[model samples]
Target: MWHGDRNGHGEGGGRGSAQGWCALALLHGKIEAHLERELQGAHGLSVREYSLLDVLSRQNSGEGGHLRMGEVAEAVVLSQSATTRLVTRLEDRGLLSRYLCATDRRGIYTDVTRAGLELLERARPTNDAALSEALDAAEGRPELASLVAVVRAL
Candidate 1:
């Protein structure tokens, strides 16, 4: 049954209307599709996998690569269980490894392998290209910066 206004106005909707929800859904879908296509075509990684690798690469030190699994999950905006699954997949592909935390056996840590570092290096150019395209699309638009600031505020 159609409960919308006869004149297609907001006469029959709640605070959060269908149009507003649809706009948000479309925005999310576009971003996800863009990232997915770029990652799959340019690098053999998905957005989630790339995000995990990026976080670990930033955390890398001179000696060895190590980051807490929970911390990585939080940084990458994934659930701990989902992060574990991603880590498992990366490990199977010789990209990373996981181990128990020395300080606390109950805690787990992840380390990027040499292969992982190599993959990150390989994917850098493609990621840079994608980011450049996205930035160019947002060029001269203050809304881009405003959107970033708003997300960061959250």
Candidate 2:
């Protein structure tokens, strides 16, 4: 099994190799922080916020990607309560709206508003650029480059 250094990576290190565990942890943080800064500075959205919006964007909810609260949480990998608070925050900004499910009044769903979509679209480039730069930085290392490519796809 790999063991990563404190920085969370060992170049050319295999998964769970002796040298590292969480081999990409540091790199992931670096890329995520860059994207976070870009989105926050330009659009006032955090990475989690953008990820939630992106998840909704891919949903087939006819009304601008409406999704049940649980569904949204699952899709974005956020806790139920966390997603609730996040939805509230976005709702407050008019970026998202929550409504009772028409057929199941007990079920509440959150939908992305035009504002949310617009912001997400704008954040896309920033997200891409951050990921691209990080990957490019590791391009010269064969193993790292391969890992970067895999992560970029993910």
Candidate 3:
């Protein structure tokens, strides 16, 4: 279990206090590290890059496999400028293409190219495995479950 013995301080002090917060931080860090390693080894993608590709590939509407840059940035918790830079990197790698949104000229849309989709598909297994491992580690632990539920709810 990720959390240690609940220092016997009842509801006001121990279990739900500093120790719990620390445990949650540690677990989140571990999961991110595992994901970073797996994605890099399996498909040469960082976790952020894989997430961007995933956001593009999972889009179900409009011209190409595309989504507005702002929407993608919001979905991936990135700043718009950061997303723009990331998109540029992907564009350079031939993983994706960008176009100005016709109706909203200032807006940019990003679409996954064949290479991007291929990389995302290739990375899926590793991502799934990392998630499974993290879930397994969290499942039997009450504190971890609570933390996971909170994050998921967000």
Residue 79, model 1, lDDT: 95
Better of 2 and 3 by lDDT: 3
> Highest lDDT among the candidates is held by which one?
3
Any runs in candidate 3 off by more than 4 Å, and if so which?
1-20, 63-66, 138-154
Model 1 residue runs over 4 Å out of place are: 1-29, 60-66, 138-154
Where's the lowest-lDDT run of ten residues in candidate 1? Answer: 143-152
List clash counts for every candidate, in order. Answer: 0, 11, 0
Ranking by TM-score: 2, 3, 1
The pairs that clash in candidate 3 are: none
In TM-score terms, candidate 3 sits at 0.75
**lDDT of model number 3:** 0.82
Q: Report, for every candidate in turn, its global Cα lDDT versus the true structure.
A: 0.74, 0.78, 0.82
Highest TM-score scorer: 2
Per-residue lDDT of model 3, residues 3-44, tens digit only:
444655655657567778887887787778889988898788
Q: Given candidate 3, what's the lDDT at residue 60?
A: 66
Question: Ten consecutive residues with minimal summed lDDT in candidate 3?
Answer: 1-10
> Candidate 3's error at 49, in angstroms?
0.5
lDDT of 3 at 12: 60
